[model samples]
Target: MSRFRRTWLQHSLRAALALGATFSLGLGNAQAASTTKILVGFPAGGGSDAIARILAERMQIELGSNVVVDNKPGAGGQIAAQALKAAAPDGQTLFLSHDHSITILPMVTRNPGYDSAKDFVPVAGIATFVNAFAVSGGTTAKTFQAYVAQVKQQGGGKGVVGIPAPGSVPQFLVQVIARKNGLDLVAVPYRGSAPMMSDMLGNQIPAGVASIPDFIENHKAGKVRVVAVMGTQRQASMPEVPTLAELGLSGFEEVPFYGVFAPAGTPKATLDKLALAIQKTIAQPDVRDKLTTMGLSVGFMSSDELAARERSYAKVWAKIIQESGYQPN
Candidate 1:
């Protein structure tokens, strides 16, 4: 063979191999893009985890990709929030949580590991849930007013109320209610709703404040009685219970919300795709029913709308926390 021809053939072989390698790398990137993960700050079998799983199933259908839920429960959702903050902004990792991790934690905790406004970009708002002030069936108080009178009559020092978490919305509400009504109700924080509900069922605590869903089952069983719900209007599930507004308590009408968020700097195109998928998922009749049955008021908000809502919610909680003079532990 001629030397020139031999050299040309060798160079041609090298170019072909390089081209094949590049094509294989491209396929890997596409596969990675096809998979998505929804991160939950709580363990499985809880409300947040259930929401994540439900959305993930529907999202997989809407997105035409494999979607999953990853639980990273710790530090009142700080660990999961931090993981998302440092994650690659590829839209694959999202945080599914409620107000505790997003709006209220930052206000009460000295450092919550991630800034809701700065570290994450809002993707969509899922739904809203109402908090309730409940008492054991064994209690003598038949109404919220009666409950207050009992607390005051028993003396301020003995008034204790159980809450799900220390820096949670229910805890702050307990403090605010006690101060406003001239009752010295002490706020007792528990790790989560499960234990708090258990204590309430055993009559270990006479009164407790938590999401209505957290106590709805027991309330139905006549194990506990929900005295008042904190929303602008009554819950459809518990229509007989009056709202804080109807009881003449202003500014207690705003319900806590659940939302999805991605790490900051996630591509706009990715965010839009996620938001659309979420909107579709929430619009499903069965999905809405499931959420409603689980105590969430099924609703939807677009990306931009959710962002604005978060800002407004944060501001409201900030004022409440400041007024209560709560210092983070």
Candidate 2:
């Protein structure tokens, strides 16, 4: 070969190698940017936090990227929702919350930090969880009817029930149940389920209302007795427990659900990818079992379906809140 041609060939090869190296580095950086952060509004050890951590672990495998849970427990999940609202719409940050922060909070409170419709987009629905009306093992009531009777016997000012938080679903449901039954049961709000459950175990309060997951373990250990669940149907894990509707509570047939949401303006592709990863993660047998054991049903909804459900739930809860005359603090 000629000397000029040989020199030109070597130069071309070196330039090609350098371009390839740069392209590889760009891809590496892009992949690194894919790390996901799941933000939980409640403190650790609560139902929402438990689900978030489980989903995060499984999502790491499904998404093929690092996933972490960031707990921002305050203001009944308002802080976490606000953080998510201000986050970059890059799909790396997600909020895992139930209806309290999404459907109910905005309706009851004047300013909940972030508007669900305007500031966020639904990614996927994780599962539905039932709230339970339970009493400590020390209580004499063995059934819902018996419990109501006992509360009635105690009379107006004496009956008190603990709730996970003020302005939460459990709190509102307590009011509805009390009014319907014509019993005067006052609600005592605690910071979260953990503390409420703590008080209940000590019998500081005779009864409490909280997500089934919050009470299931203790109930199984005979520390508490879940007399009834607030949902349309019975939970598979605790088939013996009756739904509130079965006991003539009509409007509460629907249970609260948990879902994932990202800040508005996240790319469609990113949203879809995250939704798919969530679906896959929830479908895994181990993940399904873990969530179920925690009193969550393994129901998954796609992004569009989740958005529709959220809209419908907000409307229904808005009417209920208005009727209840709950003023936001």
Pick by lDDT: which candidate is best? 2
Model 2 Cα lDDT, one tens digit per residue, 1-329: 99999999999999999999999999899877978999988778888888899999989998889899999887778889899999999999999999888887787778888899999999999898889999988899999898898877766435889987788888888888888898777899877788788888898889999998888889889899998998788988789999998998877766788999999999999999999999999999999999999899879998888888888877777777778888888
Best-fitting candidate, scored by TM-score: 2
TM-score of 2: 0.87
Candidate-wise lDDT, in order: 0.86, 0.88
Per-candidate TM equals 0.84, 0.87
**What tens-digit string does per-residue lDDT give for candidate 1 at 193-237?**
777778888899999998876888888888999989997888998
- Global CA lDDT of candidate 1, please? 0.86
Candidate 1 TM-score, true structure as reference: 0.84
> Positional deviation of 272 in candidate 1, in angstroms?
1.3
Model 2 misplaced regions, further than 4 Å: 1-34, 155-157
Q: What's the C-alpha lDDT at position 176 in model 1?
A: 75
